[model samples]
Target chain A: MSQELYTNIAIFVLSILVGFEVISKIPSTLHTPMMSGANAIHGVVVVGTILIALEAHSVLFYVIAFIAVFLASINVSGGYVVTDRMLQMFSKPKKTDDQKQDGGDK
Target chain B: MYLVSAACYVIGLHMMRTPKTARNGNRVSAVGMIIAVIMTFLIVINKHEATMTGSIVLAAGLILGLAYGTIRARTVEMTDMPQLVSLFNAVGGGAAAAIGTFDYLSLTAGSHISFAFSFPVALDLVIGGVTFSGSLIATGKLAGNISGKPISFPGAKLLNAIVVIVIVAAVVLTIGFPVNAWWLVLTLVASLIFGILMTIPIGGADMPVVVSLLNAFTGLAVAMAGFVIDNQALIIAGALVGAAGTILTLQMAAAMNRSVMNIIAGGFGTGDSNSAAAD
Candidate 1:
């Protein structure tokens, strides 16, 4: 009912529209990398959640806070790992079969 | 302050929209961030007086985070960007969880209750906890830290169902008897464990979708936290994140030639197109 809730809802709605438009165009090949990049943005969420958790006075909030931290940590570490793996995939040499196929076409 | 955060979110959304002009997008977001940072500082100064522990800690945390984020931003390649994104998301979720816990302890100081703070606080814990664990598992799947293959065990779906049941029970307990804090704690723990198991079976290729979903969770958590604390800025920021994350999830799902329902229903499987498309 507060102004804050209204603003949050508005922003949330707007962002969803924007996110849909933006992510739709990303190439399939780049999906993983893009996702990894986007995950970093979750940092903002983590920070906000942390701030809120810190303010919690209830045991329920405390439990939620702990889980949030744990989940967020997994997110950060996993995203980093995936991005690195994908990059490694790019760096690796193409299979000899693929090279041979190219030569045969020529 | 809310305006500044909104602007940052707007610019960030703009950047996210125009990936081709990503550098420009980054700049726009950066400007927004600067504004947000200043607003945050101003708020701290205004609310807590000249010098307070919260202010000092906030300043220190911001500095450290900024330094770390900057370094990562500069060095991380576009190819590895998704992982970084996931990592950042985790940090956000973790921070949220931490803040909620601290707030609960501080506000209570001793025994008894406050209905005004109860609902929001509980919401923050559940959503934030899920986001934190879910994001991490998605990151692991994406990075190959966990197997890229879709991992499904006997009764995986059933287990998840049971976990959901437990979470619901916990929620009821939390609301029915706010005085009994232990139920709340149990719920969060169960949720965290559930999050890990939920994302673990998903394959690497499907990670983009998973990340998007987790991002949405994180955002919702933040928004809930804002409600708990009656902070406009936090609410706006959280909502922005949740909405964006959900959209991204949909996009990623589409990119995979799948639907969200199919992705989750299919569970984790090694179904590479080149190798098994014809199968």
Candidate 2:
């Protein structure tokens, strides 16, 4: 088999194993955060598109690569940012009944 | 070499799945990644005809990437962990897209478009583009960079539908008439704009669904890229990503006591859902 073919197969296997490994370590409490982070990796699509666009000898391929990278980057970045903020919401302070009672007494 | 990559992925997945064992998982994953990197270099050096300069540059890239990964791993706060994850995923998607692009460009270098590869390239392009935009929007909403208030203009869904139609038409034209490369660029720009529009309407709480969906798109795009390059690894990796993303979307929907269809159809949780149970 060609070296390229062999390398591709290697990458495919690695991705799967990594996917499982990464997911497995996530805590139940942090599932959303973890998911968000992983999802954000989708942004790599931008780099991919750039590579494709530059390397593609034809205008058509270039255009396609550009779009793919542009769109995927948004998805990856936007998704993670949102998730981070949402998780932050969990750590906020909640009002206690005692505090409310004290204020009422005052 | 393949085994090394697989090991890295496995270790990473393990860390991801078992939060209590995150440290160990991370360590394993890291080591695996290092091995994978080594394998990649070995493969390139073993087969590809390249000058010493090219080899040095490639080595530098790998080292830089490793350094970045290590730094991020050590310094990133647990609260920002999700964001980090997203960043990594984006890099992966980008890498796959880049490789696919290289394959396509090499084939079409002589101005004679190879129909066999063009389709996959297009698939990767469209899907990758959409995924990138969608992820960015999701990140903005999550990070408070943008409002998560399900912004809806009149006939937003209709507009989205129109955009999809146009994109499809453009795709058809691109394939049927390779001579018209402009259509590809036009559609790409249009779709990106449409991605932003589609995402702006999604509220914060529904962000998970959006993230999941975009991830699926990323996977599909990678898989297509794989097809274009006739790379088994890309195809398998892409399919795995797509499947995993879809499953997560469903889980998120269930968490909201909503179905995937409801999430996609739009008009969810106009803010009152905050009082409603996330369950």
Candidate 3:
């Protein structure tokens, strides 16, 4: 195998290890949000779609590239927004007016 | 610069371990993606490889995608987040497979064929095809379009085995005779069918694990495309996604008290009416 391919494989293996370690400690309550967050990160595939567009020469190729770009953009934007919305639910509830007034008096 | 982007992803994912930092982590990841996109555009423009028409098409795609994604993300209920995520996974996987298809066509058309390129293209098609269709089925199940209970028929396992054998044979044929594109197409068709069959029998309680597994398939597919196209950034990003998705899949499976092996075999969660009731 070529050195480049080997390098890529090494990167792949190391990333797997990092992925395991990083996610191992997550609580079950956070699993959904974590999945959503990871979904957004994979939106990095949009970069690949852009690269493909550079080589698209025919109408058919252009169409394919366009769809890819569009789909990837959705993965990126939708993933993040949905994740944010989900995470917001896990945040502490806002203080009521009475609570705020009591704090102010203190 | 890709290294910087990769680092950001790692840090961003790390920060997600806590609720307080998860949102910020997501933003950090987004920033990384923005940088990667801009850098790729600059490189392509500098090489004068992107045509005016191509640029216009790309811009239009971005705008449309951004609008659709924003609306869908904003409107989707939290209860439906898994379904939405499955849909996103479907598109990502489909796009990666499409890239492989385009590359294969162009390569064969030019009469330039090598195992190095052909192997990755074939692998990408199979994995991407499976991910695309499997994710759609998962979405259907999660959204109540399909029964959440495991659906199995007589000889389902035997049929699944035969499909696996056919896919392997097709991949071998593509590698041995790179000029005949039929084998590659056959692989894609069979994998897509297999994807549907594989997911339909998985119970609803396992949809999250299935989604994560499909996400990993997309990652592997993207990484294979990187190999086909000789892009380091694609390789790095795709590998990270694959690894992360795999870990998440395992975690999800464990959370449901099912082994990943059992989940893949397609029968353990079939009779759990109680699980379905809880959902």
Candidate 4:
């Protein structure tokens, strides 16, 4: 095997290990947001599509590449925006005046 | 440069374990994507491979996609997030398949593709095709466009088995006879059908696990495309997605008190009103 291929394999293996370890500790409540975040990260495939689009030669290829670019971009943008919206719901609730008075007594 | 982007992804993903930092992690990952995309564009420009027409097409696509995604993301109810995620998975998988298809066509037109290249191309086409159709079906179920019941007939398993066999055979044939584009097309078609059939029987409750599994399929397809294009960044990013998606799929399955294999084997809950009571 070529050195480049070997390096690629090493990166692939290490990333898998890291991915598993980093995500293992997440609480179940955060699963949906985590999935959304990971979905956005996979949108990095947009870069690959961009590279392919630049090299497209025919009208058919251009059309295909265009759709790919558009779709992957949606994955990136939509994934992030939705994830942000979801995470906002998990933020601390604002303290009302009544709650503040109660806390002061405590 | 890709290494930097990959590092950002790793750190960003790590930070996502907590709700307190998950949004920031998402932004950090998006920044990493921006860097990778800009770098790719710069490299393409430097190599003089980017055409004016291609650039125009890309820009148009990007604007349209950005507008649609932003609007949909903002407007979609939180309850519908799973459906949207399935749609995004479909798009990503389809794009990955398209990449492999274009590469295969060009390689065949010029010269014979090596085994290393041919294998990934075939794998990408199959996995991506399956993901494309499978995700759509998943989205349909979640969106109430299709019944969220287990729609299995007597020969459903047998048919799925046949389709799988045909896909594998077609891939093997295409690798041996790279000039025969028909075999490649057959493989793509079979896989697409298999994807639809596979997802239709899975109930609505299993949609989370199904979507997660499809997400992993898309990641694997992207990794295969990376091999086809010889891009290190794609490989690393795709691997991270695949691994993370698998863990998430398993976790979701566990949350629902189902095994991953049981989920794949057409899932529990027949969608009858009493199905939940029976469980």
Candidate 5:
């Protein structure tokens, strides 16, 4: 493997650990919003879509890149918009590490 | 700049640990994405590249996606959020897979790529295609277009196993051989089939976990795409989602009193009448 792969893998492993820690204390009620939020985060694929479109020479490449961008942006925009909508409905603020049992807010 | 955007994703997710802070977290994450996009645009402009047509195509895609995504997110009923999320996962998966396929095609224009490239690209396409089709089916199940009842053909496990083998072969061939376009095709088709087969066997209370797992798959695929393209931003974002999604999947499964392996390995309603492990 190349040194780049080594670096990427290290970054990848560390990020996963960070990810697990960041949301580990969340309640079950927040699952949907959490998933939606995570969905939005992955929409970073849009970066790839943009770079690909700029470099594509063939019509086929352009078309594929265009479709990728369109889908990825939807993922980014819709993901965050909907997540915020869901989180808005909850009037109570979640206290981290205080309440273990779920559906208490309901 | 890429690292900065990735840091935004991390901090944004950290903020999401609470409800009062979640919306701001989302906003922060979006801002990070904005930074990444602007940085990319500046780089492109500085290069003095991109044909006029390419610019127009990019503009149209951005506009159309932003409009549709924003409008739909605004209007969809709260009850349908899961379905909408699944659809988003589908699109995200398809987009990542498209980038992988495009890159694969470009690289194999007459030569072979090393395992470093083929490994990530092949896996990305497989996961991406699986998440793409599987999320759509999940969306259908959630939206009532398809039966929520678990449905599986006789010998479904064997069939899925066969598809798994095909995918493995394709991946191996992609690495062993000179990066033929056909290997990627095989990989995509097989994984798509695998996704459908695995999802159709799952239904009812298990839907949420399935969707969450697929979300994780999409994230993992995006991360693989990042490795393929050697981009730090994609890797960070993808890894974050993948990790978060996995935790969500396990938590949901636990809430339902089932194990993650059991949820997946149990093959709920696999036509075995005596199998009530999930029932």
Candidate 6:
């Protein structure tokens, strides 16, 4: 293996260890939402989709690349939105009056 | 830029350790994604290989998918979150597999073909295909579209055996011989079948753990794709997800008084009427 491949492998292995340690003491109520949030993070596949589009020459290539982009974008956007919704339910805004301002900021 | 985004993801996940800060965790992760997406798009646009038609197709897909994803996310009922999560896995896996397939084809057209490239390509096809089909079936079961009971037919075991044997053969062929598109395609088809077979016999009660397992499969597939392309960000993000999913699977299984081994081995569930009740 080349140096680059070796580095990538090390990165992958170390990241897995980090992932295992990323969340701790999370309540049962947060499991589903936390899972959803993690799901959204993998939407980084969207980056790959765009990278492939750079070399799409044939119609078949373009079509496949398009599907890749489409599906990945869905994963990215939907995952985040769905996660945010769930997390919001567990969120308690103490002062209801400033809710509008908070919403505006968001 | 990619490293920064990756840091954001780790920070986001760290914040998820507590309920009070979990919402912000989601935002931080989303922000990471936005940075990565914009940076990738800019790279694509600046490249001389980029074409107007390609840009149009990419943008169209991005916009359309974004609109639908947001609408579905905003409108779907909370009770349906499991299925929705499965759907996300489906898309993520499918996308990763598609990208790997494209890269494999592109690489074969050239002279330099190495084991490192081909192995990950084949692996991605298998893992991504399984995650794609498995998650879809899980989604169906969760949505009540498919029977949540263990579905064992006369040849179910035989088919499962056949699929596994074929996949193993394809993996060997994929690694030893010169690059063949059929090997990749066969690997994908067999893995997809295996995924379906594995999920169908699992009852409703074990769907959460199964979903988490398939979620991990999707992550590994993406990581394999990263290997094919030599992309660090994908490796980090995908591996992080793979580890987290595995932990979540085991955690949920333990919480439900089930073992990951038995849950993976299937037949633990007798079609529990309250499947998501454990959640």
Per-residue accuracy of model 5 over A1-106 as CA lDDT, tens digit each: 8788999999999988988888787878778888998999898898888888887888988898899889999998898898888878773444443264444664
In terms of lDDT, the best-performing candidate is 5
Regions more than 4 Å wrong, model 6: A92-106, B109-112, B268-279
Task: Highest DockQ: give the candidate number.
Answer: 6
Candidate 3 per-residue C-alpha lDDT over B1-279 given as tens digits, one digit per residue, 9 for 90 to 100: 588888888898888887667778877877887888889888888898887777877888889998998899899887888899889888878878877877776664425477777888889999989999999999999999999888888777788889999999988887767466677789899989989988988876777888888988888887887787777666776777787888888888888898777787645235453465467
RMSD of each: 8.1, 9.6, 4.4, 4.0, 4.1, 4.9
Q: Which stretches of candidate 1 lie over 4 Å from their true place?
A: A1-42, A45-106, B49-56, B76-79, B109-116, B268-279
Residue B159, candidate 1: C-alpha displacement in angstroms: 2.3
Cα lDDT tens digits for candidate 4, B1-279: 698888888888888887667778878888888888889988888899788888888898888887888899999987888899889889888888888887787664535667777888999999999999999999999999999877777667678889999998999987866456677789899999999988988876788889999998888888888888888778888889899989998998898898888777644224432465467
Candidate 5 per-residue lDDT, tens place, B1-279, comes to: 688888888898888877767888988988998899889888888998888777887888988998899899999998998999999999999999998998998874548678888888988999999999999999999999999888876777688878999999998988788857888889999999888988887888888999999999999999999998888888888988999899989998888898877767655444453465436
Candidate that would win on TM-score? 5
For model 2 the TM-score comes to 0.66
What docking tier does model 1 reach? Answer: incorrect
Q: Grade the docking of candidate 5.
A: medium
Cα error, residue B244 of model 2, in Å, equals 1.9
Instruction: Identify the CAPRI category of the predicted complex in candidate 4.
Output: medium
lDDT of 2 at A78: 49
By DockQ, the candidates rank as: 6, 4, 5, 3, 1, 2
Q: Which ten residues in a row have the lowest lDDT in candidate 5 chain B?
A: B269-278
User: Where's the lowest-lDDT run of ten residues in candidate 1 chain A?
Assistant: A45-54
Instruction: Enumerate the candidates' DockQ scores in order.
Output: 0.17, 0.11, 0.56, 0.60, 0.59, 0.63
Question: TM-score ranking from best to worst?
Answer: 5, 4, 6, 3, 1, 2
For residues A20-100, write the lDDT of model 4, one tens digit per residue: 887886788888788878888888888888898888888987998899889888887887788888787765452355468
Which of 2 and 4 is the better model by TM-score?
4
Candidate 6, residues B1-279, lDDT tens digits: the string is 589899999999888867767888889888998888888777666766887777887889899889988999999998998899999989999999999889877755324477888888888989999999999999999999999777766666677788999999998887777767887788888988988988888876888889888888888888898888778778999999999888888788888998887776554233332363444
**What is the DockQ score, from 0 to 1, of model 1?**
0.17
Worst 10 residues of 1 chain B by lDDT: B50-59
Clashing residue pairs in candidate 4 are none
Ten contiguous residues minimizing lDDT sum, candidate 6 chain B: B268-277
